[model samples]
Target: MEPTNEDYTYRAGDIVYVFYRNPHTQDVANIQEAAVVNNPENPNELAVFLYETYYPLTNEMAVYSTEEEAEQAYHHYFGGI
Candidate 1:
């Protein structure tokens, strides 16, 4: 998923991770993980926009290609998500 801030650590083409919600329970039980990859065929805006748009309900703290990096960034901002 995309980071809320424009100047974020993650970028297009990165394997963004998002902990999506369980629609049924509305809880943080489900994971809406996805890769925010940029497709050359589409516009840059459209490519990046999909990441966040797809998982709007996710309590996404941070996004990175690697799990290790993701955790660090996630907690750094959210303190613990």
Candidate 2:
């Protein structure tokens, strides 16, 4: 199915694509999507389900505002895989 334009935010329940950097991986940079599940236990950190690790929603990496952008970014990174 095609994706629709939607404004994404850091608020809980919003779907977003988070960019990660790993030296061990094939690509130094990677992108993944997860729902915004804020860690109420700690406001200093951001959390999301289905993610390998808990990363802060900071400016160090990219965060696509919508699923459409995420899909395009994924395809671009994975060579349209």
Candidate 3:
């Protein structure tokens, strides 16, 4: 068995590589969720939440600025993701 999309688990702030479908093509984006500012709650988790404007619209993954920044983004975006 392979990892399905549903297998991805996201946390508050973590940098991720998101693969999404563009208008007529496939695109990949780097995103970072607002949650994992510092260290992730679960380091073992594959996916994590991010707050990059491009992520939402493009369905790309989150790329973290910094551990602290990621955390701050999480709180700012989701009010404490």
Candidate 4:
């Protein structure tokens, strides 16, 4: 199924920045670039390719279209580093 939010939609090949926390190191969180692509399990849905994994794209994900925007959000949420 598609994302519940109607205001945002990502197409295949779109580059988005997301605030990601390292799975192995829970203390490390940073902004990372991800590629939007069709979900392998569901062609009609979109997913983000990052950290060598595929994640479903939803409104809940801290996704931004540009690095500057992502940085601003990162600083706002993380406060530093």
C-alpha local distance difference test of each model = 0.47, 0.59, 0.38, 0.83
Candidate 3 lDDT by residue in tens digits, 1-81: 211233343443444443222445444222222432322443433333344332231124444435565556556764663
The top-ranked prediction according to TM-score is: 4
The CA lDDT at 28 in model 2 is: 59
Predictions: Cα RMSD each: 6.5, 6.8, 13.2, 2.1
- Two-way lDDT contest, 1 vs 3, winner: 1
Q: Which stretches of candidate 3 lie over 4 Å from their true place?
A: 1-59
TM-score of each: 0.41, 0.52, 0.26, 0.86
Output the TM-score of candidate 4.
0.86
Give the per-residue lDDT of model 4 (tens digit) for 1-81.
Answer: 555323666788989888889889998899998999888988888999997789988887778888998899888888965
In angstroms, give how far residue 32 of model 3 lies from its true place: 9.5
Model 4 ranges with Cα > 4 A deviation? 1-7
Candidate 1, pairs of clashing residues: none
- Candidate 1 lDDT score relative to the true structure: 0.47
Which candidate should be chosen as best, given lDDT against the real structure? 4
Sort order, TM-score high to low: 4, 2, 1, 3
State the lDDT of candidate 2 residue by residue for 16-81, as single tens digits.
775555657746555667766565667655666544555555444457866677668877876753
Tens-digit lDDT track of model 1 for 1-81: 443433454556555555444567773433335755454454333133333453221223434455666566656755765
